[model samples]
Target: MNIYKHTILLLFINFLGFKTFSYATFSIIAIDLHTNESGAALGTCYTKQFKIYTTKLNINLADYVVLENNGFGIMNLQSDINDFTPIWLSTAKGILAQDEPYYTAKVISKFLTQPNQDYKHKDRQILLLKKDKYNNITSEIYHGENVTNFKAGKIRLHIDDRFSIATAGNYMTNTHAPEIMEKAFIAAEGNLSDKLIAALNSIGLTNDLGDSRCRTSEGVSANYAFLRTFQNGKIKLDLNITTDEEEQEATSLLKEKYEFLQE
Candidate 1:
């Protein structure tokens, strides 16, 4: 029903066992007008076991928000750490809608327009992204260079009237999450679901040259959510999985499905 309720449910289920897939590396949230739904996706690359766990959520009901990390992104996950960053805390809020097209921009504007004093991050950069109606994605970046006070700028991107996607991640310059997700989104025929799947697949199958530890014993996993409000006031939730042999083994151990089958 509510975002907090959904978050608590996710935590409950995670403690019940989905905790293994909680180590997120990169994430993407997509709102598709064609389908009148929104989905959140994430991917992790771990060297400890050579497995990448990916989960996609299809939301067609109420508004939703999510937080993802690569285990190294935060000191604790329970403290409302919602941004995609290396050892940073930020909240990502989304207005899941079926007909209202400006909902995504509204949420993003709210996030950036306010001075978030709750975050524990300093001397850090801010990244904002928005996809337009013509399928064009625009972005804005704010530098954290300061001499004294912490102040955020009020710059907005030119978001379109059609469907859109917003993605974020924490990594080095060469392995940045936004770049990877954007590439995958464009390559996947500009479809949110396919883009997320492709992004996760790439994260698992390929190694970032900038990440030397990715080949070591550091673990990686990803969790996601999808939400939307239907015209009939009906809510819909769907689950999809993408994985290889190693990921399959890990998910199987958690008693979770790892296939996007035609059912």
Candidate 2:
């Protein structure tokens, strides 16, 4: 019986991952479904393997519209080196909801890498097989409990569009992984106490976390992506959090405040 259930879950994941967009230089109209009053046209060009998503947004969604164009100029830059390869590295957007249809739609049509005219897209995606609407929902993604620490009086929720990225914030379909870090404190503790979240949300770490390119075991402070633990006697606001060492007190203080672990 357990095996049957597990198989079902895996099959379900097949229904909510990625999408296939046409390889063409075209424009897509993004109408804020929430607010019909505003809309924008995104300029994009797609090749067999690479895609470049672009747009001009004059009005911003007050609280981020799902699948909205985020206006990123260089998810893939058309460099002379990449002239013909069919692979895409795109900006994903959206929140992960375990109960709701929680996946980002494919809205890109550009290429950043080498264009492969003979690139044959044979992989079938059941998630995007629906007529038009995206039906794939997200399963709660926990990297690991040891990877994070939560504070008291504040609930920390961690989510990721691992298999399929969403279009929710910054127009990049893939979310700022560090963003949830900020929201964790804001939603639960009702505070941005310091710029801890803001500093983390900045890019580079977005792809650098865990990736050796961002950090090395030899230098923990030099690397940007980290969720390490700290120790503190007093809960002092981190008015100046520039390095991991500097962030130590603040993280220690937050963990102490929440009492997530006893050490």
Candidate 3:
């Protein structure tokens, strides 16, 4: 079905209350911005209690993009184009009702390429990221150590997206939404519920036949996010990273002049 129709349906179910998960909620309509580079992923999800905005901006998406990477970079969730929606609960304890992201540390993943000389040689004394045509982001993944080297996290990311200026509705609160996270998604049998569940399934998520869970598609997907439990730590990738000596200097330079992640 079209997004407009689906959005209206989602809102109805959210406000009217359905016979599924007791705290079933609806996500805001996400509008895919058509712009430079790859593009930007922008959307707004809200309830009377809170509003959430998502800005998966890619630096390359800028008209005259200037990034710390020196060259250009991409930013987005997936490379392809499609629409998706899914609802899941976070298992975090004790902090519902609060409205903010709470990552214990900055998430890190190995990069496809090391940061630019500006970040490395101190040519540009600032923290920067790159984006794609649509403005998603050339996501800078780093090794876990990379984050430990700094000190921040992602759960907080969820908070930032939900309650930051970058998002819609401007929900400026430093609290958590435990009611939204702790509550299980509503996906039993019914008209709207069934339809919503089916839409989620189409996007790679499958209702867990077992108790207390749902499953998502494996491998990289265009418009879906999944959680994977990795047994092996210390990820091994043939990344062309900066040498230890240079990386230290680069880190020091950045600490002096820039902020990578912001609220």
lDDT per model vs. reference: 0.35, 0.20, 0.18
Winner by TM-score between candidate 2 and candidate 1: 1
Residue-by-residue lDDT tens digits, candidate 3, 144-243: 2221111111111111121100111011121121112212112223222222222222222222211111112212111211111101111111111111
lDDT of 3 at 246: 13
Predictions ranked by lDDT, top down? 1, 2, 3
Each candidate's number of clashing pairs is 7, 34, 50
> What's the lDDT for residue 156 in model 1?
21
Error of 2 at 150 (Å): 23
142, model 3: CA deviation in Å? Answer: 2.4
TM for every model, in the order presented, reads 0.47, 0.20, 0.17
Give the lDDT of residue 55 in candidate 3: 20
Preferred candidate (lDDT higher): 1 or 2? 1
Off by over 4 Å in 1: 1-24, 45-163, 171-174, 209-215, 218-237, 240-259
Could you say which candidate leads in TM-score? 1
Question: Against the true structure, candidate 3 has what lDDT?
Answer: 0.18
Off by over 4 Å in 2: 1-104, 107-209, 221-263
Candidate 3 ranges beyond 4 A from true positions? 1-36, 40-48, 52-71, 76-140, 143-205, 208-263
lDDT of 2 by residue, 183-240 (tens): 4323332122222332333222233321121123322112111121111212122111
Tens-digit per-residue lDDT, 154-177, candidate 1: 222222443344554443224354
Residue 176 error for model 1, in Å?
4.0
